[model samples]
Target chain A: MQSLTALLGLLNLIFFKPYNAIKMNHLNKISILFFLLLNLFFTACEKDNPTPGEDFGTFDLIFDNRVGDQAVSLVNADATEFPYTNNMGQSFNLTLLGYYISKIELAGPNGEYFADEISTGADAAQVKGFYHVLESDPNSQNIRLDRIPAGKYDQVTFTLGIDAETVQEGATGGVLDPAEGAWLWNWDAGYIAFGIEGRSPASPREADQFNPENGVQIHIGGWKDIAGNANMVNNVKRITLDFPSAVNIESRLSPNAHLEMDLLKVLDGHANNVDFSTTYAVHAPAKGKVFADNLAAAFSVDHVHQ
Target chain B: MHFSNLYSFSNSLFGIGLLALLLSSCTREKGIAPVAVAYEFAAPAEFPDPIYTFKNNPITKEGFLLGKRLFFDPILSADHTISCASCHIQSLAFADVPLHGVSVGVNGLSGTRNAPALANLAFKPEFFWDGGVTHLDFAPLNAIESEFEMGSCIEDVIEKLNAHPQYPSLFRQAFTTEKVTTPYLLYALAQFMNRMISDQSPYDQYLAGTAKLSEPEIRGMDLFQQHCASCHDGILFTDYSYRNNGLDSLAIDPGRARISAFAGDHGKFQVPSLRNVGVTAPYMHDARFRTLEAVLDHYSEGVVASPTLDMSLQRGDQLGIQLTDSEKAAIIAFLHTLTDRDFLNDPLFRRE
Candidate 1:
């Protein structure tokens, strides 16, 4: 916004001043030209203005993916190691699992809600609340929540997928930047709200005379819904998880929320247990809503440390 | 002569000479003095707010110039033989010149759709013939990574840019970051393309009550209002909605269906802005029409029937509007009035 003002001010100097000065006295014209040049010099120097830092508390949100009691591992080089099995009796191995978490809200002691500011700028400078959680890297698992007021918070809530405004804003920088990977579904013009990719022998393609080890690529994404159409609901799922107990937070103390994601629940928690033989790959919103629902239901706050 | 008159004469000459110096300064490659002036992106009275996230990436002279350089530079391609300007030339209203049915890429491969014009793009909510890319900032990624186009990924382009002796510093000046991230690159390119506003046409003047259109052009305008206005509506000349437009019974490209993944969206393509329709040809998603005459002919009698065809185009069984030769001629004249010669020759937009 500051730059916009500078731009307008500069424009007024060039266009508005020149138009009026062209008809004015000679001395005035010469003085105005010098003044214009002087303004330009100052504007150039202002380009390097240092971004002021804000004083705020930070909170860490940690995500850990698991199956039953054992931690989920990436597929090995031999490709024969399958450690987890779903309720449908299909053994599978995960190659990738990632999703976006945004619009986080923390309920304070007196029922006051402390919300983290959503960075809308397309630059790394605007990064704050948004984070990408991937199972492959433990370092990437920790999402730093900034600008929280120093206070005691009880319940924590966050959306499983990106909000409508951020989706509509399109590709931004930092975690939301599309250049980081193929998370942004180019065709749909929306982010893959939840992604789970792996290989399963029980996949329908394996039985259909294709590769015996057919891959399971599940990308849940969609953001538009026609008013009358129930089937066309773009699967933009929002999940708000309450901690098993209230978390105590303070300015001096660094608090961490350790959350656990049970893959078993994603496949077998509901009555509609996913069978890899028939349902492995899902791209549409209506088809993805089932998985989105399952995935949203899978996360629980394991513990909170203050 | 009075003393004041002599001073005024000399002062006027000095002003002309100073203006020449300033313009020459703008054309310099580097070491040009930083001027406080910047290009303004004021939306015309008739136009809506720009779709670009200006609050995030503010417009600056250095930023716009960096974007312009990238737009014209072939370094963004794998072989360094093709730049964005290869397909979007300024003289042709930023559409591919010497029109090809589909744009050819690095290795002589061809794209699936015709290269659309890059005029008044800041107003568009979505982009591409299929409306696949939602933001103007994300649009370049499609072309950069396409095997049929630049044949270079963002990673490679970033490496090349960082390695370049000049680009790293230029990136720093445009965006305050030392390392060129994907967002800064996109933001810079967008800054250049978003400023490509083409609104000073004779039609715009007519709206502004500053210019008068000829009788034939007026008649063509009337015909346009009656027939083409529904789809090609608004001052930007597009509603930005995807429609079948009865282009094909069985679409070869699958158009909007590729994005929506629905059979109902098959054969649909985004309605392109006709701001510079006269110069930007051959037209359509496949470059099917070489001239405005051919485009008019398509609407008059060439619309094909399909299940996904826009209902508005269906008038009984026979598709398309009925137009005589005179009507076609007048419409063509009216389209010509939509051209703005000033934009074509704008020195600010030109490469240094």
Candidate 2:
């Protein structure tokens, strides 16, 4: 309680300069009163409060990968079974598919906002909020955000890939660690935020090992926007989804938002139609801008469970 | 008014005291006395502020030593035959030896570009001829993962480090981590590279007014400033800009274009620092020239024009800089002044 008071005093010193011999007007007095009340309210919420509204609970985000209406299933690299077709009618099978999701935010109709803590550092423990959701890894799909205040949340926002600002923070561990399955482009010094690789009969036989004969690999990753250089494109996409229904989060009740990312929408969206025959290999950022433009229409909140 | 001023002054003093107390308390909790920092990165007064993110990876004695060990250890290679030290030798100002123009990597594979001398790297904004890597921490990754260089993945290197008897403990002591991770590994290497500050050369002494240059050397310095200093500018040398210096009419490598994906950037490569140019030969990205004389000759007579040729090199119809034999010789004399013998033979940088 004393520490809280000291913190409030420090805030007063910073915001108001209370130590200075300045005249306090009516507006200043009212604002100070409002600020103190707000501080007290927040302090009360932080403590072990029995208040119903001030209670905190967990919020889970479950990403479900899909191809149009059907759920996704991983196949072998050289599998002949072509399950999905794009707008171009080019059939393809997924050998690998994954994307990095970070900077999560939950919003409500009311003034309740919960932003997941985002930090980047060399320490694996300190690096948080970034999630690498791969079709191969079942455990990586579900992200649980704790310490969310009890509220009725109806919207969620997240960045599809790591931004240039975060990338410039230098080397980071955990999911961002290149040594530990992180899709890092060492030559360009950035992460391959979104990637899908498979083989299509439409795709031509190439000498490149990464994009082999009839192999379709589209990696959307560019996080730098050099001024006046239109060629250097930043393909990192920010996605916001409205929950089908408002879900309540309380001490007793935890909410889960199920989001489905359709592969068909990304490949055959209104912005760009990706033909596997000609547009099979995309390894650079400028090449991935069209696919990144289709990302906003690709994701939707399927449902919410309280 | 006087009383108020006194009160504010006392308040600030109290704040400083509080901060000092907190700092001391932190050290006390760690149970370690305040020791003189041996590995602190001190930028020379004449050099520009370092572009490296030293805040993320601060130089410590343990960390720098660990980095030095990793640098010298060939365990980072695929077959454990090549290390960072393999290409970057300490004697030749951390550049490859003269014989191996393009240093051989794992399994006798040679890279396309010459291994440039490693000095004042902390001041450099980017690495390599392509200038793709933005941070010093990410520079080693290319060498480690490149097909011709270390020919090993970072995952394998980390695994090798974890399994090693000394590496894990050394990493723990350096970074205070339980396990060997990529960031910590990169941090250690960065610590060592950041300490390679070449600021004690004769030219540096000339700048500091402690040493005098010979008549030819002084004339060479004047000529260098008139002709070369535009591209290779300032104290650290090299303006850190990518340019096509008329190296080839048709760029086989497609140098900077490989990274920028622009036709205009084709045949462009980073203008390397001339800090230790005398010892670090053969010169240029492809290691085309064998001697300083040959390099100057290329500048004077052998310049091949291209679309993306540097504007400074193209004087109307003329392709390269005009220089006489005496002028070239004078510039060579001045270039020799940049070779810092103290840095080349520094005991701290030498592998134990």
Q: Which one wins on lDDT?
A: 2
TM-score of chain A of each: 0.74, 0.82
With a 3 Å backbone cut-off (N, CA, C), the pairs that clash in candidate 1 are: A40-B36
Compared with the true structure, what per-residue lDDT tens digits does model 2 show for residues A103-178?
A: 9999999978999999999998899999999999998999999999888899999999998778878899999999
In candidate 1, position B60 carries an lDDT of 71
lDDT of 2 by residue, B247-309 (tens): 889999888787778889999898999998899999999998999999999999988988999
Q: What share of the true interface contacts does candidate 1 keep?
A: 0.41
Per-residue CA lDDT of model 1 for A125-244, tens digit only, reads: 676667678888787788777666656666778877765577666557777766666377654566787788788878755423323357677778876643322224466666667766
For each prediction in turn, the share of the native Cα contacts (below 8 Å between chains A and B) that it retains comes to 0.41, 0.85
The DockQ-derived docking category for candidate 1 is incorrect
Those runs of model 1 whose alpha carbons end farther than 4 Å from true positions after fitting are A1-60, A76-78, A144-154, A202-213, A224-233, A251-256, A267-287, A304-306, B1-38
Tell me how candidate 2 scores on lDDT: 0.87
Candidate 1 positional error at A107, Å: 1.7
DockQ of the candidate models in sequence:
0.22, 0.49
Number of the top-ranking candidate, with TM-score as the measure = 2
